[model samples]
Target: MNPVKNMRREDMGLQWLAIGLFCCFVILAGGLWYVQIVSFKKYEKYREVQSYRTVRIPAPRGLIYDRDAQLLADNEPNLNIVVYLDQLREDFTRTYHDLKGDKDLPYLEGLELEKDARYLTVSNMVYEASVIIGKPSALVRSEFESHYYRHRYMAMPVLTGLSREQMARFMEQGSRLKGFDLEVRSKRRYPNGSLAAHLLGYMRPRQRTSNEEAATLQMSFDYELPDFMGKYGLEGQYEDELSGEPGAKSILVNNMIYRQEEEEWLPLLPGKHLYLTLDTDIQKAAEDALRYLNPNQQRRGAIVVMDCNNGDVLALASAPTFDPNIFTGFLPASVFKPMIDPKGSLPLFNRATYGRYHPGSIFKIMIGLAGLESRIIDPEVEFFGQGYFPMRGRRIDDTAGAGYFNFERAFYKSSNAYFIHYGLKLGPETIVDYGNQIFLGKETGLLPAQETGGYFPSKQTVRKGWHPGDTANLSIGQGKIDVTPLQMAVMTSAVANGGTVFWPRIVAGWESMMPNGASVFEPEPEGRIRGRLRASPQSIEILQKAMLADVENRNGSGSICRIPGYLIGGKTGTAETSFKNSNGRRIKHTWF
Candidate 1:
């Protein structure tokens, strides 16, 4: 009688079970959709945090060329042998197993065994690399452990700056040296060694930037590759342009901090090429001449040559120049000791721009111009000389013969007595007027922060001091004025270019190099004039004639530089310095 009722109850129970199963399927599908489509980015970022390491990579440095397109400063490939820790993961585990042989250890001992295993594995590979390169093991246990803990994703260098023989040896058996590989990087090179060293400057190895604020506030890094920074001259002046922009890369790693793969995060832009206005041939000649003139090789002096028409510096040379290559890395004490000579011949000092000395008779040209502009000096008029001029109860001596000297004869013979007489008549105000026109007391702007604004007495100072002896010293270009060879070159250029003083030019331009070996140039306008002289053309012409006579006449002090048929012009002087040298000797600055 209850059979029909039981069958109905069973059917109801089956219906309830099917409905419950359907509800469970719906909840699972909704949860899958929310996780797969909505929260994907959040989990992806979490994965990256645990597995990826970011590294800062330095860009290649710019190439430096001379006026002739010859490389003055360059970059050459340096090959190194290193062991990639990532590739040694298997060896580390196998070595740990081997070291733990036949015993189970405590947790602390086991951790140290893992450490020993890692160092032993890396050290063994380093020994293999040392054998191949014929060098000692560069690996240290403590350093290896520290690196393994912190930067296990990076490669460790085993043999660096490989010599040609070492490189050859490695190449012969590199394939069998598992986990060790060769990496080529660029390094600064000066092919001519000390040639144009001061002008070209040197670089220092830097791992990070000098923007301390940015480094502290914005820039963060776990690791970085070494880069170079310019320290002086043209290299230093254009640091931003030469170093270019830095980039970054991402290292995909496992839980063991071993790199599995790598991907470039930001592409690096290469630096521009710099072209200088200097002529290498002229620079070499000037340097050779300076070396030749100083037979003892201890002279501390400088030379500057310029293009009178446009103010382009053709050559600039400084004695006791250093080989800039030594500065790229750790400077050895032996090489550095010789550079700091006891005689005050510092190789790092750039004398062409930084040296200051009494201009002596080279200042006579400005004095003559002042006299001519004042209408007190007539080129053809003759004056009597007693071999010295009397002033301030003192006599300024002259090398010229005591005789009647017309302006031409006086100038050609460097008649200090004649010029001093006229210079006194023109007075300090008129003389300073001419000096200002020639920019005698100002920096030439050839090298910023490195050039000196040489000393020239101002009218205010002269008026305050007002000593007749000072005026007498000022007359013959002796007491109060100082200058650099670069300044003299500029002053001489003003005379040669008919009184248009110019700002000396050094760097010519910069260019971007293309991958296909072609260059895209960015030209800088040349021959920028600093100022124009107030003297007339006739005055300049007269002064030029006098300078020519100085070189042409045998009685002239500058006659030593005279070459027949070329009509070369010059002035010579030996000036007394107020300071004593390091060896307690009085110094004199001699000039041409």
Candidate 2:
């Protein structure tokens, strides 16, 4: 064997080994690059999914004010004692280990153990917190368990609506309690109590929104802080504007599912303030007038005052009122029972907008206009009355005695016979046409879902199935004709402000919250005009004189409603309704 050949063979074998080692090194480097750069974002996202949670925070609601800038509905600070679950992780683990001891317990399994540990830890903390705060506090086991299962990411509320004394105690001693703190939240409050309760409406607990942004975040939300909703009146009408845009926060958690820190990614946008046309003083006066009118308050009625020039509602008062603040907290059965009573007075009912009543002689205003427009009767023309008007051989009795009376005399006396005579002479279609012109038998479109379009006979019904008896009943705001006090106010306002009928205005505009809170939005000028009366100027003048006579004349029936310094003019009315009594006997429902 040659030595040189053997050395060459060994060198070649070493070369082959080096080549194999180089290939292996190249493969390792390529794999490292792919993992460190190409797939970095995927793994990072996986880590984030395990440790990050998104929470929704409700934005503060806007304030509500009257025309004079008086606060009607507002948000007051509410102190609550809350438990942060993430901070309690160590305590929960410690409790679980203590309960387990040195042996494996059968009950200490996944869900059961977690629930038991959480409840025990939170309950003990709540007890300790109670002593520190000097208030008796309790956390139900079921409540704690349910909260842990459903809303583990959010802070659990243990004690809510703390008073000043309790809050002071908590602030003084809260530092000693782990995972416990006082959170200041806003709560709806009506400072004036029951005043304008129906107009201001009430608020309910926060609920999840159904807006577009909320829909996108529905699946991503780990915990959602609720926002309040308006249940009625102006609050309900403008819910979206009053409840501002919600903000979002992200919580960075540890491997143990405990929160390390939280950052607000989206800041809340505060809601715009609302300004209403209601005058506080006038509203109080109207409510007081209604209350004192009848000592027993058995007389259920409503009063509505309006700005004849602009159609802005000044005051709307309804009897059997309730304090809207009752809805803010847990309502007692004593307070709640009467409001829901079906057989008794419904205090929740807004009589000014919802109640339907026979306008009685007030309908005579429309009848007088119809007669003057259609040339059926003159204001000075005298009609002979025999204490009652004859209709289809039946007599409709009048409060005014039999006499040869003109329009002014009959109007001041509220003569049913005189009005009924003109009502029949004008025919049902002519009268129904005039009623429809003023938006009778139609919704006023003021307060949504809070108003009703009272019953008014259609022209078709009067023309197709016409009857003298029906005509007679319809003549004096009876039979099928019914109206709300708000509607009557509009009618009165139309008479006062020439022939233009304006849509009733409740909310004046949207205002800012800053000092001097100027209006951001106002109702359009044309939005206030509902319709205009087709009556001639002379006709309106005649009706105005007759109405004034009803208040100023010596024989006036509406003299009781007269204010000494004010030369106010109004007409009085009485309506009769039949109903069966508890003894099954017929009884009359009289309204004056």
Candidate 3:
């Protein structure tokens, strides 16, 4: 009697179970729809943020050229073997599984095992690359591990500065390797080797400044290419103009962190080219002249050639130069040590502008002008010398010997007695005033951070310690007087060009390189006058005539420097200097 009722109840229970299952299916469907459609963009954006990466691309540095459009400094393409970490992820996973199965290997776990796995995979790739390039290459374990941990998004460099043959080999075989690629980078090169090293200066790897680091922290970039910075000379002076603006690139990556495609977000703006006014031919000539003066190269001196009409430095040469290319990368102690050696010739020093020397009889030119201005001596006046002059209870020797000397004869003979006599009469103030007019006590403003304004006694210094002996010493270009070869060049140019002092021009102008390979920029004007000497035309003309006779006359002290039919006028003199030796004994230094 209850069988039919029981069967109906069982059917109802089954119906209830089916209805509950249907309800659960509906709830799951709604949840799937909410996740797949309602918030699809949000999760997609999150995935993109995790997978994609931004990279910073460094712009190429500007080119440097000489006055005649000769390439001095330029960038050369350097080939490098790079390992794309994104493409190595799958290999890293597969290698990790294989490594885990090795029973003979030491127990490794967590990050340590993962690091070994990544390094092993990368090392194998490097070995394969080396074989293809026909060169031996290796990856440091610690370096690879550190890079994997900190800079996995960035490509790891396996081989740098590849030779042309090696680069060609890699280009052929590297495409077969999944994560391997060849990258070309611009490297700074000096085409002239050591020529004009001191004037051109050098470069070093750029480091992120505090401000740059802070700015980078605010932006998003997964990798950054290395940059360079100018260290000295014109390089340092025009750093901003030479270092171009950096650009950015967006790297599209897959879910496994493999790079898919890359697009440059911003194009790099290249730096402007720097054109210097240095004449290579004249520079070589000036250097050659100095070398000829000291055949053994033991003598230290500087020679400067300038355009008399404009004060443009044609050449500024100093002995004992160095190659600037060594500073482009890591500077070894072997290369850098010699430059800093106290006992060495100091090849890094720009002696033409930085070296201060006693002008010797050369100062007589200024003394002659001073005497003329003070009316103490006329160009035609004659005086007698007794081979020496007695002063301060001591007799000052003269190289010109005892004779009756006019201004022309005394200057041509470099008569120290003749000039010293007039110097005492003209006094220190008037002489210093004339020296100031020649810009003797001030910088020439030619090369910044590469010039020294040679020491000249100020009126205050003279007034504080006024003495007849001091006046005599100052008159002969000794005592407190000092001059650079560059200053002497300027002085000589002023004498040649009727008293107009021009600010020495070095860098002619800048030219900007455009994408179409065309250059654009304004040229800096030539012959910018700095100041004019206060000497009257008549005084300048008299000084010029004396200078001409000093070289043109057969018995002139500077006759040795005379050129045929050039009418070149010059003065020569010797200065006495003393320095303490290593044993603490004073030693005399004779300078010409």
- Which ranges in model 3 have alpha carbons more than 4 Å from their true place? 1-25, 29-48, 51-55, 102-110, 212-223, 250-263, 293-299, 514-518, 580-592
| Candidate with the larger lDDT of 1 and 2 | 1
State each model's CA lDDT, in order: 0.84, 0.83, 0.83
> Which 10 successive residues of model 2 have the least lDDT summed?
518-527
Q: Which whole-number lDDT from 0 to 100 does residue 361 have in model 3?
A: 85
Q: List candidate 2 stretches off by more than 4 Å.
A: 2-51, 107-114, 211-220, 253-257, 294-299, 332-337, 513-527, 580-592
Backbone clashes, candidate 2: 1
On lDDT, the stronger of 1 and 3 is 1
* Residue 37 lDDT, candidate 2, scale 0-100: 100
Q: Model 1, range 562-581, lDDT digits (tens) per residue? A: 88779788777778787787
In angstroms, give how far residue 406 of model 3 lies from its true place: 1.0
> Tens digits of per-residue lDDT for model 2 on 294-347?
968545668899998889988998887888988888778897897879887798
Error at 257, model 1, angstroms: 2.9
In model 1, which regions exceed 4 Å deviation?
1-51, 141-146, 210-220, 337-343, 514-518, 580-585
Candidate 3 total steric clashes: 0
Cα TM-score of candidate 2:
0.88
Lowest lDDT 10-residue stretch of candidate 3? 102-111
